[model samples]
Target chain A: NAGVTQTPKFRILKIGQSMTLQCAQDMNHNYMYWYRQDPGMGLKLIYYSVGAGITDKGEVPNGYNVSRSTTEDFPLRLELAAPSQTSVYFCASSYLATFTDTQYFGPGTRLTVL
Target chain B: GQQVMQIPQYQHVQEGEDFTTYCNSSTTLSNIQWYKQRPGGHPVFLIQLVKSGEVKKQKRLTFQFGEAKKNSSLHITATQTTDVGTYFCAGPIKGSGNTGKLIFGQGTTLQVKP
Candidate 1:
């Protein structure tokens, strides 16, 4: 399996601009998540999905939106970019929600909002 | 709300020296998991601790889950250059139930000088 994959390894956006971060998993995981990590800071969940067509807000979902159109894809959207939104974003997936389940993360996308 | 906090945001060790990082959660966890992220890379699953006061080891690394199920620790017996990366601890959000959303610690960045 290719595990989880995220598009655009790095990007720079101007204030007020918008873009979508794409993510996909070949592992057929029912659980997918989006997280952001600031420099030297721990990650904060932005949004997540339990399965195809199901999504939920997370700890830091104000500036972001997400859609799980299929079991393999969970994309994040930024409506109006802000400098505070600049950070490394990660996509992850898990086969299940059991206590023993482990998350597999994709190489993060680094965003710079100017 | 749940929060996971990690101590010693950054640690630098000489080759062959030992290093450790600690993680604490504000709420009780059914389980805790550890992940390692290399510089410019995505996070990779390390291990999961489900039982209270659990201790697991992998090669030169040791992981422990607190008896209260709200704390954990990762220790490296002999630091190696390959160990240079950030370590993170994560747990499922209480009451979320089978959704697989997690709260992650800020993370501890280990720097080993060879």
Candidate 2:
């Protein structure tokens, strides 16, 4: 099974450009999350969705937007990208709320905003 | 806002040496989880601790949660090159009213020399 799949492994965007980072999971998990990792900084939550059509803001959601149209897909949109948005973005899904529940992650998308 | 902090931002060790990383949270957590991200890779779940004073082991690695549920530790015995990565600790903030949100530590990067 392809656990989680993310498209456009790498990309470079100029300031004010916009793009979407697509993420999908085949595990049929109900909990999905979007996080960004920067050098010397831990993974910061950008957005999360508990189910289709239900999304919530995370710690650093100012420069991003997310939509959960279906249970299998949670895409992150960068509208008017800024240099601060340059980082590695990861998509994760969990089957349950238990702490022991493992979160399967996608290969991640590396975005560089100049 | 809840904050998770990790100590010793970076460590370099010989292949056979031991290494340890500590994580502290400003507030008590409902559960704590650990993850590892290899070079050029996404964060992968390692293990999780729920109960107070809980300890779990995975081969050469040991994980522990403090009695107060506000701290944790990950120790790797006789580290190898395969252990090179950034280790992160995450937990759900208690009383946040949002059970799905996770606060992550800054992470500790490990470098093992041959």
Candidate 3:
């Protein structure tokens, strides 16, 4: 399995611009998540989905949104880019709840908001 | 809100030296997991601890879960240049139920000089 994959390895966006970050998993995981990592810092969850059509806000959901239309895809959207949004974004998936499962992460997308 | 904290934000060690990093959660965790990320690379799962006072080892690495399930630690014996990277600990959000949402700790960046 390809596990989880994310598109747009790197991007630079002007203030007020909008964009979508795409992620997909071939593992058929029921849980998918979006997280952002600032330089030299831990990851902060942006959003997550337990399954298709079931999305929820995570610790740092502001300035971002997500949609899980299929078990394999969970995409993140930024309506208006901001400097604070500059970070490396990662997509991950797990077959089940983490309490009893492990997560597989994708190569992150680095975003620069200017 | 649940929070996971890691200590020593950074660690530097000479080859053959022992290295360690600690992780603590604001609330008890049902399970704790560890991941390693190479420079400019995505995180890869290392291991997970489910039972209290659990300990697991892989080659030169050792992982431990606190008896209270509120902390964990990773130790590497005879560190090598290949061990240089960031180590992160993660756990499911305290009240997120089975959504499998995770909160990652501020990672400990390990620098091994060979």
Evaluated on the second chain alone, the candidates' TM-scores are: 0.98, 0.95, 0.98
For candidate 2, list the clashing residue pairs, or say none. Answer: none
TM-score of each: 0.97, 0.96, 0.98
lDDT of 3 by residue, B52-98 (tens): 99999999999999999999999999999999999999998877888
lDDT tens digits, residue span A48-104, model 2: 988899998888899899999999999999999999999999999988755556678
lDDT of 1 by residue, B45-113 (tens): 899999999999999999999999999999999899999999999998889888887888989999999
Sorted on lDDT, highest at the top, how do the candidates line up?
3, 1, 2
Computed on alpha carbons, the lDDT of every model, listed in order, comes to 0.93, 0.91, 0.94
Which DockQ value does candidate 1 get?
A: 0.88
| Cα-based lDDT at residue B38, candidate 1 | 94
Per residue, candidate 2 scores C-alpha lDDT tens digits across B22-45 of 999999887899999998988888
Model 2 residue runs over 4 Å out of place are B96-99
TM-score of chain A of each: 0.99, 0.97, 0.98
- Looking at model 3, residue A63 earns an lDDT score of 93
How well is each residue in A1-114 modelled by candidate 3, as lDDT tens digits?
778899999999999999999999999899999999999899888999999999999888999999988999999999999999999999999999847798899999999999
Winning candidate number (lDDT): 3
i-RMSD of model 2 (Å, 1 decimal): 1.8
Tell how far residue B96 is off in model 2, in angstroms: 4.6
Please, what are the lDDT tens digits per residue for candidate 1 over residues A15-48? 9999999999999899999999999887888999
